[model samples]
Target: MSDQATLEVRNLQTHFFTKAGVVKAVDDVSFSVGKGKILGLVGESGSGKTVTGFSILGLVDEPGRVVGGEILYRGENLVGASQERMRQLRGNNIAMIFQDPMMTLNPVLRIDTQMIEAIKAHQKVSDDEARQRCRDALGQVGIPAPEERLKSYPHQFSGGMRQRVAIAIALLNKPELIVADEPTTALDVTIQGQILYEVQKLCAETGTAMIWITHDLSVVAGLADEVAVMYAGRVVESGEVDGVLDAPQHPYTAGLIGSVPSRNARGKRLQQIPGMTPSLLNLPVGCAFKTRCSYSTPVCEAAPVLSEVAGGRQVRCHHPLATEAV
Candidate 1:
């Protein structure tokens, strides 16, 4: 990993102030992404992974706001940056690829119009040049007949095609950072593989840092160099891919690995992490996973800090699995 990382998030706390209660979506989360590296944010739904992404991109709206955090982009603080500055930074220096392609593309406009507009929005380029760049980007993502596709509207393309366009739009800027939130969930295995390959190539060629948020360990196993597993609005463990996947330290991490069908022990039923994640608004005392952790101990009554173990891995638990003890 590079010593000078592209992005660093320290003590992030995002909360939504609702009439019911204050929902702590992302509670004191911290991680970093190095240049040209893909960091996988793996967690179940409502684990605050997507919220953390939005928080980094400054997309969280009122009612839900990033209350405390230091979002450092290449040593600059993004948390205190002005809205205008952020607007200029987003989609130009740092881009985000949302799960839904339609969210970024307007159905009323043709592909060329939308793509060209995005290019011209940040650069002093002519419409023709922008159009050419758009075509190149489309081709980069393995979109066939890019020239023809540029003339078509959103409704004219398939689900996978639209996602390709979205991915293309994200790559158009050759951004320094990209946060992709499960952009391939709807795609079939083959198409997903193609997209993943394209994304990897884009990052390798441009040295772009990426945070790929997904619930699929298989996806991370193939694409990410580092992995962070989150539960109950906090990262339970994070480290190099092989270390975390092969010998997970935290029980939550172990349970997640066990739940994967392909990882099940031969002739044995698949293991699952019992109980759902607790409500953020009404979290239990001590370690959030204590209730569900089979290895829980009296020390779990107090919240555990993320302790650095071997291989630079970090695990937040009073008593980690003996198999991975440092």
Candidate 2:
């Protein structure tokens, strides 16, 4: 990983205005990804991980907007950038891989057609040149017989293969940063592992920073260099993956790690965090995890700002769990 950060998100607040009330989809979330490094944005559904990715890409549509903060891509603020500028940057300087492969692939189009279009959209290349680039990208993602796969349609491939195609598209431009939102969630474990390895290798070779958004800690443990845990639209804890996973200081982080099946003994029942995630529109005051956290106290009633608890580690909790206990 390079010393300079490729992307820096500072106090990002993306909100949705509905008839019922305002939904704080991403509130004061902050993190950074260095060149060739991966930051896993882990959180359950509705925790704003996906929203954050969308905000960075300028993809949030009607009724929702980035209300505050800066999304600095190589020192340039993209929050106030023009639509034309964002369009130019989207598939060129930055790319996003959504959870569903169909979101990226057109059912009626051949894989080669889509991939070539993606390349030509940013660069003026000849058809043959674009096709070669497309073939090379497919090969990079471990697709078998790239030449043959390029001629196939979306439906001709399995779920995992389709995802590999989507990933290949994302890598076509060799963007400086990629925000992958659970792209491997539906794949079998073996395929997911293969994809992870390929992605990590790509980042290292190309110096492309990545934000891998998922709820799976095991994936993050193996793939991400840094981890950020989100709750109720805010980052609750963040640090180097090893330190955060082995010695989680935040109660929510601890709960998440404990709930992982491998963390339990051979025959013991898996542990679970009690209570449910609060609704964004009607979230409780202060710490959102307090209701479910065993260490909550009166001080937790007041919102806790992210504070550095140790070197390169931060947690948003009045009474953070002890590292040893975790």
lDDT of 1 by residue, 1-326 (tens): 34788999898899999999999999989999999999999999999999999988898988998889799998888886899888888988898898876565788999998888778879999888898999999998888999999999999988889999998888888899999999998788898998899899888988999999999999999999999999888988999988899888898988888899864367787778899889998888889999988888888889999888776789998888875432
Task: List clashing residue pairs in candidate 1.
Answer: none
Residue-by-residue lDDT tens digits, candidate 2, 2-91: 366899999999999999999999999999999899999999999999999999999998799999999999888999999999999998
Candidate 2 Cα outliers beyond 4 Å, as residue runs: none
The per-candidate count of clashes, in order, stands at 0, 0
TM-score of model 1 (CA atoms): 0.96
Candidate 1 lDDT at 152 equals 95
